[model samples]
Target: MLIGDVSRHSGVSTRMLRHYDALGLVRPTGRTAGGYREYSPEDIRRIFHVESLRSLGLSLKQIGRALDDPSFTPAALVSDLIRWAEDRLARERELLERLRAIDASAPEGWQGVLRIVELMQGLNSASASRRQQAVLSRPEGVPMSVDVLAGAVLTEPDPHVAGALRWALARAGGDGVAALAAGVRSADVDVRRRAVRAIAEMPEAPDATAALADVLGDPDATVRGHAALALGGRGVTSAVPVLVGMVVEGTGDVEAAEVLGALSRDPGCADRIVTALADELAAHTEDSAVRIRLTQALVELPGTTAADLLRELTHDDDRAVALIASAFVGVLDRRSTEDRDG
Candidate 1:
């Protein structure tokens, strides 16, 4: 076949076929009377080999070596090509994400697009300070997306930076709740913790509350504690048990206690909190420290129920529990007296 026929048959263009001939990669094995290049069947087969290798992301130089060099082993070259293609794919994915974010921002023009890009770069900066500044210094009209802020919050390691990111995400409205929920399901403990923290800071969206409730069963104690504390504060009765457990274990016991107190304000959940605390007290009677923490948490409950529990705990066998409960009862009594006098 002539060059034109081979180009038509193989899909390799005429220019590229002649270039392959110039490189001595697929020279014709014969010529016509008019001195035109005539490719024999073997030459056409070689052209097919070069084009096949090119499809696998091999450069022209790489393809030439693969077809002509006996010493060129395909394994290493194939591995390198795989790595290159993976890198290109990763870059393409990143580009698509950035474009989507810009699109979501609904940038009005080139300036708005530039602002969005700058904010994105700042969020992704290696310096935590820069990342925080990116979130904090967002332009007034640029309309940052919640996903960008949530993504930063999930991966942020610096405490101050994470707090700033969470704050910014919360202020951005509940749009980031989906992203934060995704973070909650992450295998990374830190990511899960940050996700819950960020979600807790947002306005009470049902999705956020539901995600937090689902997290109560997480194996990570700190993560469960965070979720429970957030859910309890949201008046979620299901969080009462986890909060009660935190009280028993003394993990985030203060926040747990406060949230439990808040939940107790609800008439429906007040009795449940009291019962859970009472049960934990019985289950771990030998654990004085646990008893003391639970006793301290009891004071957080409203009305005379907690006072009554404190009165009973005042006579308990554990000296520390008795002293703490008695002290709390006395405080509650003074507050009651002051209320009556007013």
Candidate 2:
């Protein structure tokens, strides 16, 4: 087949085919008697492989090596590809997260803010009263009372009403904490679960740290998961052990993976984080959101371990992971070049 035939069949432009030839990525098998380049069926196969890898975000040099190396296994090539993909996905997710934060904090009219504040206060007062009643009535065991309250708080007719309830729970004092802590023992799963979420956000509360640590052992996975989230938000290093334990025990649980990923962000937890990812114990179990979080956390690690793991992840089965790894590689490469110049 001629170069044009290979280009048409491979979906690579003629110029790109020439460029690949120049880079030794998919060179023709030989030249015809008339001085035209002739690509064999094998060359066409290589052309398609090169095109596929290029589409996957491998650099020309990387693609060339992949083509030249007969010893490179499919898994090895895919692994390389995953690193590139993971980096790209990480960059996109970071941008998206920043956008979300901006949207959430966007300026609103004074009237709107005031209305939101009023709704929050009212909701908080109502929730506190209900919680106090539950505490007084059920002191030892409440069937579904906590669940009922949680349902009311989360499913409130208005967004402002829900936000208000959250704000009020966040601001509750000693009595509020005690009531919530007691509620965690409620027989109603929903009640215990919601209470855990509310309590996690009370980072400034006197006993918030201890309360969060206690809930880490909640029988309900949702409660335990929320506690992990709260620990991250509170930046409480005390929760690291519990979180890591969760990672080890719940290696296949997506929620546990999310928490482990978050824990990896703290500078103090870098070693543990890298160990977890490198081991690939809980790494592949991560859901899309957790994978994004993991990529971000991995990017924060300072050593070659992080880079190597990321490079490995570039060929992950998950496309999102691969994209993020690619973006990370780009960032690392840029930083490396910058340091060399400096």
Best TM-score among the predictions, by candidate number: 1
TM-score of each: 0.93, 0.43
C-alpha positional error of residue 135 in candidate 1 after TM-score superposition, expressed in Å: 1.3
Q: Which ten residues in a row have the lowest lDDT in candidate 2?
A: 139-148
Off by over 4 Å in 1: 204-206
Per candidate, the number of residue pairs that clash is 0, 32
Off by over 4 Å in 2: 1-160, 172-174, 237-268, 281-297, 300-302, 315-324, 336-342
Residues 179-277, candidate 1: write the lDDT tens digits. 777788899998898888888887556578877888889999988988888777777888888888888888899999999999899888888889888
Against the reference, the lDDT scores of all candidates come to: 0.85, 0.63
Q: Which candidate is the best by lDDT?
A: 1
Model 1, TM vs. native: 0.93
C-alpha RMSD by candidate, in order: 1.9, 30.1
